[model samples]
Target: MKVEDFDMFCTLLRQRSGLVLTSDKAYLLESRLMPVARKWTLKSLDELAVAVRSKRDEALLRDITEAMTTNESSFFRDQKPFDQFKQVVLPHLLANRAAKKQIRVWSAACSSGQEAYSLAMLLQEEGARLAGWRIEILGTDLSSEMVNKARAGLYTQFEVQRGLPITHLVKYFKQMGDKWQLNDDIRGKVQYREYNLLSDLTPLGQFDVIFCRNVLIYFDQPTKSKVLEAMAKLLPPDGILYLGGAETVLGITEKFKPMEGQRGLYTLAAK
Candidate 1:
């Protein structure tokens, strides 16, 4: 693809999905967009670029944006966060919300439901502790395809093997042909929806904890600040925010302060 065409494509992606792409990322774009190009019977990446440049076809632009967004994820990815959730966050939330008898969690950019499902399993293990509590675990992603997969609650053997404990897998999933179908009991705990971090989140409501890991790295600084600010508004003053190890609240916003004991955890500071 020509440099000008590539720049236009990158700009379009940044505007639509908040994904930042450099000239070095041309190969990445080609790898992801090639399939879309073929599906549309386009001869080459350059041709696809022209189609995107037309801007008259919003559907085509959406297709391109969706094609570029990464949807890779697995069950209970990076076990530490979930462990902390069970050991610290859940207990605190349970105690604090005892009177209300309800708890809310938002898994922003939840690719295929694993993070939300992991939380469900943790809550299930708590058993009677959450008996009367209204547990709302909401998982949202920019990609509609990913939200659909999360709703399906199906996983391949390889997918189940990654980051999931063998014991939980045996207990919560049943064999469906060669794949594992997450038990409806666990599956029902999470509600998946299509959401874009770049857009307004008023319809999704608030949360006690929000897990938005490893996603903001793809976004530019302005987009990251915007997203973090929006998330801060949705979170309670004491609500927890969990970010990827590479991500931090520092330099992004001052609304959140890193927790003293937790590494990747942050809490909205008191006024």
Candidate 2:
């Protein structure tokens, strides 16, 4: 790709997905977009950029964005977040939301639904404690392909093996030839949608707890601040946000502050 074409591609990525594609990551972009180019019958990334510029085809633009943004996700990824959700967040929600008897969790940038389903499995373990409560898990991602896959609730052996415990695997999944089918009971707990985080989040309503882990690291500071503030608006005073181990709210936004004893756990900053 020419320097100009690469810059245009990077701009396209940022405008469509809020991802900051630096020059150093140019190779990464080319590598990922190659399959996209072939899929659209374009001979080169430069041609792909030309097609995007001239035609501005909605499908083509979406393909380019999704290709760059779609990333790997696994069940119980980075153990501590889930553990904290169960041990810390859940207990607080149980107490605070007792009167409402309903709770909603948003798995932002939820890739292929593993994270949402993981929460479902966790809640399932709660059993009698949440028997009468209405529990909702909304898994949103920029990739429609991933959202549909999440809706399918099927996982290959390698996918299931990543950070998934054998015990939970047996309890929630049934063998279907080479793949495992997540039980309908767990599948039904979560909802999947194709959404852009940079867009207005009001339509999604509010969430009690949000798991937006590992996503903001790709964004530049301004984009990160925008996303974090938008999320803060959706959270209640007691709402919790869980970022990836490598991500943080400090120096990014005043909407949240880290819980002193916790690593990734954050609650709304005091007004």
Candidate 3:
């Protein structure tokens, strides 16, 4: 792509999604956007850029934005966060909210629903303990296609294999021809929606816990701080937030502090 075209494309992405694409990552534009270009009948990224620059093609622009957003996810990804949830977070929240007997979890930027489904499986395993409790798992992402997939609860053989134990797989999934479909019981526990982190989050309601993992890595520091602050507003004083291994609250916002001895876990800061 031409230098001017590349710069305009980067600007468009940043304006729409808060993603920062420096020159070093320009190759990503060429690689990830080729399919988008072809879909729109553009011969090359340069043509795509020209189309974006020359016209207000909302549909085309939306596709480009969604294409650029990272969607990498797996069941029980990164192990430790789920471990912390099962071992520490769940127990603590259970005891703390025993009177209410309700808990809500938001899996922010929940790409394709793996993390939310993982949580549902864990809760399903503890079904006896939560017999009378009200549980809601909200999984939201920027991609409607991913939201639909997550809602369908269908996965390819390779998708189910990643970080999914054979025992749970056999217990919870039934093979449908080739792809594996999660049981209705587990799939029913979670809700999926298309949401932008940069948009208003208050409409989603308050939550006891949230998993905003890995997504802020794509945003600039200012955007990171802004998004974090918005999330902090949705939490109660004792609510927990789980970020990716590489993300931290240290330099971002003062609304939260690391939960001692818990990896990727944070709680609202004390008054």
Cα lDDT listed for each candidate: 0.89, 0.93, 0.92
lDDT of 2 by residue, 1-271 (tens): 7999989988989988998888898899899999999999999998898898899999999999999995789999988898898888888999999999999999999989999999999999998889899999999999999999999999999999999999998999999999999999999999999999999998999999989999999899999999999999999999999998999998999999998798998999999
Q: How do the residues 1-271 of candidate 1 rate in per-residue lDDT, one tens digit apiece?
A: 7888888889889999999998889999889888888988898988888877674487778788889998878878888999899899988998899899989999999988888999999889998878888998999998888899999999999999998889999999999999999999999999999899899987788899999999989998889989988898998888999999999878988888899989999998777
Ranking by TM-score: 2, 3, 1
Output the lDDT of residue 52, model 3.
Answer: 84
TM-score of model 2 (CA atoms): 0.98
- Which window of 10 residues has the lowest lDDT sum in candidate 3? 47-56
Per-residue lDDT value at 161 in model 2: 99
Cand. 1 Cα-lDDT? 0.89
Q: How close is candidate 3 to the true structure, as a TM-score?
A: 0.97
Collision pairs in model 2: none
Which residue runs of candidate 1 sit more than 4 Å off their true CA positions? none
If ranked by lDDT, best first, what sequence of candidates would result? Answer: 2, 3, 1
Select the stronger candidate by lDDT from 2 and 3.
Answer: 2
- The residue ranges of model 2 lying beyond 4 angstroms of the native Cα positions read none
TM-score of each: 0.97, 0.98, 0.97
lDDT of 2 at 217: 94
Model 1: colliding residue pairs: none
